[model samples]
Target: MFYPLRERISTWTTSQQTAEEETELIQRKRIQDLPLLRAAKENDIHLLKQLLEDKNCDPFQRGAVGETALHVAVQHENLEAAEILLDEAPQLINQPMTSDLYQGEHILTFAACVGDIEIVKILLDHGANLHAKDSWGNTILHILVLQPSKSLLCQMLDFLLSKDGGKTLIDIPNARGLTPLKMAASEGNVTMFQHLIQKKRKIQWTYGPAATMMYDISECDSMEDHKSVLELIATSSKSQAHKILNVPPVKELLQKKWQNVGRPYTWFLTAVYILYMICVSLCCAHRPLKPREDNVTNQRDITIYVQKTLKEAYLSGDDRLRLVGEIISVVGAFILLLSELSQAYIFGLKYFISHNFWRDPFNIIRICYSCMILVILGMRLTDADGEVVPMSAALVLGWCYIMYFARGFQMLGPFTIIIRKMAASDLLKFCWLMAVVVCGYSLALYVTFQTVDPQALGAFYSYTMTLISTYCLFSNLLNGPANYTIDNPAMYSPLYSSFCVIAFLLMFNLLIAMMGDTQSAMAKKKEELWKAEISGATVKMEQTFPKSHWFCSESSGNDFKETRYISLEEKKWHPFHLEEASGSSSDDESDEDVPPQNSQERNPNLDPYQEIREDITDRAEDRGNVDHNDNEIWEEELFEF
Candidate 1:
């Protein structure tokens, strides 16, 4: 009996050891599956398949996180593994294995949050509910919309919209009591906001408590809150406000800043006026009666005498004062030209007057002084001593006329084209014309001095000679072994004169070529203008009449049917040319209908006149109503934050 008990005890110990070994083996198997589950969770499909091929592997088995292979595959967006798992075991897709492990996050919620549209589609295809919500009470659509990718959001939104009972998706609120529209507005997702608006329009959704609360908060007393509400409304509407908001407010602010800074041109005109007045006052103070024999030796003394004599003639009652006026003008002109060409006082005088022109009467006085410069040039050229040159009066006048006319053509030709292109309004054109006249007078004085004495030409003559020499050199440099000769009357060379004639012909040819180019540019510009008019008119006509009136019969029954056909054809072929001409005519009419306003007619203190006037009136009335006691109430309270 004792031997039998010992054998039974040994068998019991052996069985106990085998049971412990089996448990150890099971534990080893469980530990080995950890990496495999991790690989599955990371969407490493090859490693997962290898782990599944292990003889110890159970496909239905849960990991430490209670996430089965199928749940892991779906959560990681491994669509291939999901397909395989579904094929192998179709029951795992809907199984909520990780609800207890991952703070109640289901597999579908993970897929939606990650924006795995294909995985989400697969789950839906395999009998996953479209309206499935996570532990946070957030729908799959809500999670998908929150993903950063706009394209993914659009895809998910489209999918939800196409599904049965999908209209209620926008109505579903999160834990924050904010609907999808409010969330989209708050997040500033413009495209999502537009999508929501379109959905609301199609479904005719009534504004719920959440939308009403947002509206109420928008009207709160704080400026910050008011601004936030305006932004929210502007974002949510998907209307004109959205387009306007996209255009930066800083652009308007910069424009206002520039206006307040004032105009450089105005300051320039003012300085000119002041210098002119100073010169006039000095001339009036020292009026001279006659020219002196020593005037040639001291030109400044002659200039002062001539200026004084002109002032005397201007104030005199004698008829002979007109002839005296002419003589004074002639002397004054010669002096001014000499001054300009010699560059004697040009730089110094310009620097002196530069500071004074902008003040009051100086601006106007400077403009009048500019007129004197040209008058001086003409008089000097016409009144040179006949005895010195032995030229007749008519001959002198003819030369003067030719020189002045050619000078005017040279100055005015380019200026006219430039001014025409630059000035958009008639008033601006008039201002530019006056500016050109002033500039022309100053240039005449410069030219008169230049032609009379080559030595007196200064930098202006040097620059001209340099430019001509450079052009000749460049031509020689570009085309080797070419002869280019310039005129030198001092040398008395016939060859120089012949070369000059050839150069003149070549220059004339160039001028002709330039004119041709200008003509072509003008023609092109005209064609562009016509095309613009045609396009504008066509758009107006189309807007005036419906699409049906363009091609369809007027009869009610036939018009509807014909419009569909016409619209179909239009979609196929746009035919912009056919519509352009009519559009242009309509545009012309509209342009003509709008009356133009002058600067004087517009209120200087206000821009966007109607709104500014209303704001001013309201503020004035409010100020009038306020008493002394109200001032205390109006004072802002300082808050310590």
Candidate 2:
């Protein structure tokens, strides 16, 4: 009894498992019938209807190719059949056909290729994905060209183009890298070829096999097609292909313009030299001195001592005076040269720094010169005996500065415009200019004291200390470390007051204004150069016209010939001599021909030439009626010439 019960349980389990397996197999068969049902392929539809009518049938079936019944109907050029199936079961249209197997030959691809415009419209209306690429990466347009019907292909293209068109067909390449246009050319489809040519006028035949294939197609039937191909090939080979391609012409033009502008190395040097000279002049202009006593006793004592000292240490001849003058001039010139060299170096350094060179040669030279000058000043200030004054060092540094300035000036000779403009300006460029002047003045005071009394090194040292303190005050003011007010009451002494006033009015104002003016002028010149560059670019662009074949057609050529102008001007293009060509005389023309004259031409009393004379007279009368303020109008008229 137990064995019978176990056998019965096993039999029931086996039966249930068989039923589930059968159901799965039936579902799989229904899925496989989907593409056939969609394509309206008769046999597939019969099988689908049979499955649907039966209680065990699956209406939502997909085929081996992952295509549903609707996909098959659309693909098989059966739009009516698809519509019937969709009306019966609307959800089927929304299902995405599996793309794994069919590649570039999906349902929509089939519809587009087969010229089933109605089916495509229905699918699109049902929210079919237009941008969907097939397994082989072919778009609807790509599939359309594969069809034989030219009219249908054109219709499909027009429909796709109607919404957000002007996209390049060349972007879609087949497995072999052949564009749709190239494929059309290969198939000797003149209509498709011409359509693509018109659309993308600048399209080139660069793909090797595709180009050869195009040539082969053109040669298949007649020499005329071959000639057309040859002509296209010839045009592609020409240098004007770049122009035809509509590429900008400014880059090449700019390169040529820069070459013509020449090198700016020399101008850089000149600017440096001028700056150096100004610095030296500023340095030499003022010197620190001890206050002189005016009282009778002190004056008599000082005078007697100075006279005895001068008598003992006097130079014998004009040679010393001449030598001194020469040295001063040399020093001044050296300072000028150094300033100019530094400026030139600054300008050149801009270009060099772009290439990652951080060190500027001119700046280094300036720093060295500054250091040397400081050393000399230190020696003069510290040495009680004045035995190690480093006169040779001072002279050497001065001469070096001069040589640098000269070299800079020579380099900048070609930029005469820049130099003259800068020199005439009131811009203060170099801070060192003032520093040098102050130092030179301090040194001069030391020299003067030495001349007065050969053993006055201590007095000279005190004066140098005062000069250093004054320089420090100026430096603090410039650096904004301290306010520029003269807080030190000692600076209010009559001697210091006069020097400060002179320095402010003469040196500082003049130098600053000159530098400002120079900068403005240089900026203006650069602007002019930029304008010239733009103009050159415009001219280059004009010369590169005729890139678009549409603009080079027979009608365009004729229009160009008639106008004799490169750019289209509406007023110029308006036809003249219309009445004469129509054989109509002025008298014979009705009121319609003349119409009513506008306000500008309504004066009937004025003859053609008399009207012109009257206009001039009216303008003169208007001028005569104007009021003058401070004789401003008269001055303007006088200067009009």
Best by TM-score: 1
- The window of 10 residues in a row where model 2 has the poorest summed lDDT is 212-221
TM-scores for every predicted model: 0.28, 0.26
Each candidate: what lDDT? 0.44, 0.45
After TM-score superposition, the amount by which residue 20's alpha carbon in candidate 2 deviates from its true location, in angstroms, is 37
Off by over 4 Å in 2: 1-55, 60-67, 87-104, 164-170, 201-641
Model 1 C-alpha lDDT versus the unseen true structure: 0.44
List model 2 lDDT by residue over 1-641, tens digit each. Answer: 77998999999999989977876576456644454443356535555455555665455666655567777677667766676666667777556666443444555566777777788888777666566566566666666656678776886776665442335443466554445554554444556655554333211111211211111121111112222222222222222221211111122222332232212222344465556445444433322222444555643364311111222222545434433543454564456446545645854756544321222243344545555555544443553223223334444454444432332232432243344345333222445467666676555544444434333323344676647645754444422122234232232344344446645666667666776666675655443333232332223232333324222222211112112111111111335677647654656777776657644478856665664445444533443222234135434533552
Residue-level lDDT tens digits of model 1 in 431-481: 454344334433433343345444433322444553443344323432211
Cα deviation of 506, candidate 2, in Å: 99
Q: Model 1 RMSD to the real structure? A: 29.9
Error at 121, model 2, angstroms: 1.1
